[model samples]
Target: MNFAYELPWYRKFINESDLVFCDGFGVLWGAKLCGYCIKSDNRMTCPDYIENLALACEQENISLFLLAGKPGTVDKAIAKLKAIAPNLKVKGHHGYFEKIGDENEAIINEINKFRPDILYVGFGMPLQERWILDNLTRINAKVFLPLGACLDYYTDAVYRGPRWMTDRGFEWLTRLVIEPQRLWQRYLIGNPLFFYRVFRALIASSWKNYSKMSKFWRT
Candidate 1:
């Protein structure tokens, strides 16, 4: 929601996406306030569902290429994934390379050579989304999945907090506590700001509807 609120282009990208799921409670609640029937069960965070995704891909004989995380982080995540699904075919590259010119071309060539069924890019929100928009036509992968910081959690490079907190939509609180220096603004200010925007939009929508009803009654 913050991404959409901050970057108008981001909303267009999401709307153009073939599939979009609720990855956080903010989006779920926002949808509810907008009169959508989204529920907690509909939320699927990558850290929570990644193992299952690997297992399912293994069973379905789908190949995965992970392009995210710092140096060595993606390799560690692939190692953990292989442990969970021994037969899973997966490869990975760190997201530290340049996104344009020679370096970007090389990475694209590498991915095309691998010909993965799914490509996971986790350079973070707007950047990852922009990369996909720019290179989707040239990429050989069948699916483009943007996962922010998921590999860090998979490799334990970043702590994801207890299951209790994460399961109950308090993962933001946990993250705020864990990386206060890095993420203070995102969770501290961004969360409340997101909700405020949601409510504002909801109220505006309600008033519009009420005005329409009033006109109908007068007619």
Candidate 2:
């Protein structure tokens, strides 16, 4: 019952599986294009991500922890989990971001001692993913889900746009409306850059797949 988490490089350990990279905007589309099963429920608040995750932990009877995100967010996140799924059993939890520096031995040490089955790090992409890539072996976990801003959104610490707006793929826009000053850079710069990279990857993958199929038929 070994589940391989996403780390693109960790593919070596996961001979056969999707190992999604925990991004509704990035890996979800990546998985769609690559034929891997990408799983996420973006229901505005989208507690399902953690809800399903809690179910996974309960089924496995393995320890789990929220390893990153703003202070107090994890506690707040847990409350929603309890509210949404009161019966769900969690092994344990912790949170501390911004304060943790590079090498973050304390964080690594704590995780190692508990040896959880899953580590849901919502420190945002690349950074969260990179954290897992750099630390997972040292820490104990079969699955690592690096979620970006998921904790804030899920915990209700931050607000999500209305359902209609979210459905239209402009939840980020609604967010900007709510927290204009704080979110300006994320929506203005990060959002566009994220889509650009996503689409670019899609194009590259499509061309590669077409080339492969064309060569196969030709031969």
Candidate 3:
């Protein structure tokens, strides 16, 4: 939401996505407030479904390429994933390289060489989205998935709180507690701002409807 609010291009990117799924409770609540019938079951966090996805990919013989996390995080995640789906064909690269010039070109060439069926890029929000938008034509992957900090959570590099809290939509609170210094602004200011925007939009929509009904009654 913060990304959408701050970056017009990011919002456009999401609006134009082939498919978008709710990853958190905030989005579900916002959609509900907007009169959309999104439910808790619609929320699909990566940590919760990654193993299942990996197993399915293995069974379907789909290859995956992970491009995110710190130097060792991707490898750790791949190891854990392979344990669950031993036959899963997957490769990974850390997300520390430059996204331009020869380095970026080389990275693109590497990915093209692999020609993975699915590419998971997780350098966090707008960065991942922007990278994909800029390189969509150059990349050969069939599916491009942007997952923020997913590798960190998958490899236990970052604690994802307890299942009870995460499942119930209090994961943001847990994250705020864990990385208060780094994430204070994101949850503190961003959460309220998101809901405020939703409510404002809802009110505007209601007013528009009310005006239309008033004219219909007068006629």
| Each model's lDDT | 0.91, 0.61, 0.93
Report the lDDT tens digits of candidate 2 across residue range 129-192: 5566666567777767655677777767777767676655677787788888977986797656
Candidate with more favorable, higher TM-score: 2 or 3: 3
Whole-model lDDT, model 2: 0.61
In order of lDDT, best first, we have 3, 1, 2
Task: Give the runs in model 2 whose Cα sits over 4 Å from its true position.
Answer: 1-18, 21-46, 83-103, 179-219
Q: Go through the candidates in order and give the C-alpha RMSD of each one to the true structure.
A: 1.4, 6.5, 1.2
Residues 68-184 of candidate 1 have per-residue lDDT tens digits of 999999889998999999999999899999999999999999999999999999998789999999999999999999999999988889888898888878988878888899889
Better of 1 and 2 by lDDT: 1
Clashing pairs in 2: 124-148
lDDT of 2 at 139: 75
Clash count for each candidate, listed in order shown: 0, 1, 0
Q: On a 0 to 100 scale, what is the lDDT of residue 103 in model 3?
A: 91
Worst 10 residues of 1 by lDDT: 1-10
RMSD of 2: 6.5
Model 2 TM-score (2 dp):
0.63
The model with the greatest TM-score is 3
